[model samples]
Target: MSTVGRPPGRGTDEPVGDLVSRASQQISALVREEMRLARAEMTQKGKRFGMGGGLFGGAGLIGFLAAQASAAAVIAALALLLPVWASALITAALLAAVAAAMAAAGRRQVAEAGTPAPQQAIDSVKADVTEIKEATHR
Candidate 1:
């Protein structure tokens, strides 16, 4: 029966230079793959952040319209008992206070989004480096 593959060049023992070159190529490929993975992870997180922010903006727009209608109604009703300007001022002050509170809460939510760094990729790279060092030393 004929052998299936090409005959092996040099039996078992590979040259030091050839071994080092192969190791270098492998390490380079591994680093590239890790970087690609990290980019993908960060991109996913960024999309979520963007989506949340967009939703918040849409909600703010709708809320603004609702508040405007409500404030006008309140001012008109209050104006029946008090001066028009006074009713308007009171309504404005209440709306301003609510806006301030909402702003603070939104800021906290955004801040909680945290850093987008690829922590898993970083740790994996660190472990790979350590393993390479140990192998090289041996």
Candidate 2:
């Protein structure tokens, strides 16, 4: 009973050692592929997190500038109660509002990006394990 055309372990003539070796090799390949997928997924999520963090940094810088402008506005208002100080105050307020909005957006982005875990890869690995177990039982 030549089993050259059939899959491994399916042939009655093949040695048990050969079947085990093939199964181990296939399992190793599957694990490597799953690990690669996990790494890629993590890298993508990391990029999203980096972008969100950058937005937060930008918001902080803007907030600092608004604070400086507010200080200048207060000084102008105290030194000379003119329309210029009022305009400065308005500008500072607008900047501060913009910073707040940016910060909120960044927070939302980070939240939506989710945890750094490779959820898809985990699910795939779990499914693969289930399939292998079922196959072994059969």
Candidate 3:
């Protein structure tokens, strides 16, 4: 369905230049397709990433409120006969545990995502360069 791959002056007995032009056009089309594929892949990932970030933000907001409420509870417990430092120490430990869990989860997500954009772009560019070089030499 692509006329671009047809050598120039096809019916008129084309020369080598026509062949080169056709090759170039085919290479161009291949590059465009690769680029389109890359963009679509990244766009889909970006949308999922956006949604995940929104959910994370909402969760973070709720967690912050809960921590604040815990701090208030700690203060009330201290006022009612619980030792102040003991309450604060317990709250601090709880916050540290939560922070460690969140950090570990975030790191796992980052590792799973890998180098999506840059690695794909690099591979595609390398392929295009190799194709162009071969086309030119032929």
Query: What are the per-model C-alpha RMSD values against the true structure?
Result: 11.5, 12.8, 12.5
Alpha-carbon deviation at 39 in model 1, angstroms: 1.6
**Cα lDDT of model 1 by residue, 1-138, tens digit:** 444573556444678998799899999999999999999999999999999999999999999999789889999999999999999999999989998999999999878976688878999999999999999999
Q: Candidate 2's C-alpha lDDT?
A: 0.88
Clash pairs for candidate 2 = none
Q: Could you give me the TM-score of model 1 versus the true structure?
A: 0.51
Among these predictions, the greatest lDDT belongs to: 1
Once superposed on the true structure, which residue ranges of model 2 sit more than 4 Å away at CA? 1-9, 81-138
lDDT of 3 by residue, 1-138 (tens): 555867664554568897799999999999999999999999999999999999999999999999799788877786577677777777788879989999999999999999768988899999999999999999
TM-score per candidate, chains pooled? 0.51, 0.50, 0.48
- lDDT over C-alpha atoms for residue 72 of model 1: 95
Per model, how many backbone clashes are there?
0, 0, 0
Please identify model 1 stretches exceeding 4 Å from their true place.
Answer: 1-12, 82-86, 89-138
Q: How accurate locally is residue 75 in candidate 1, as Cα lDDT from 0 to 100?
A: 99
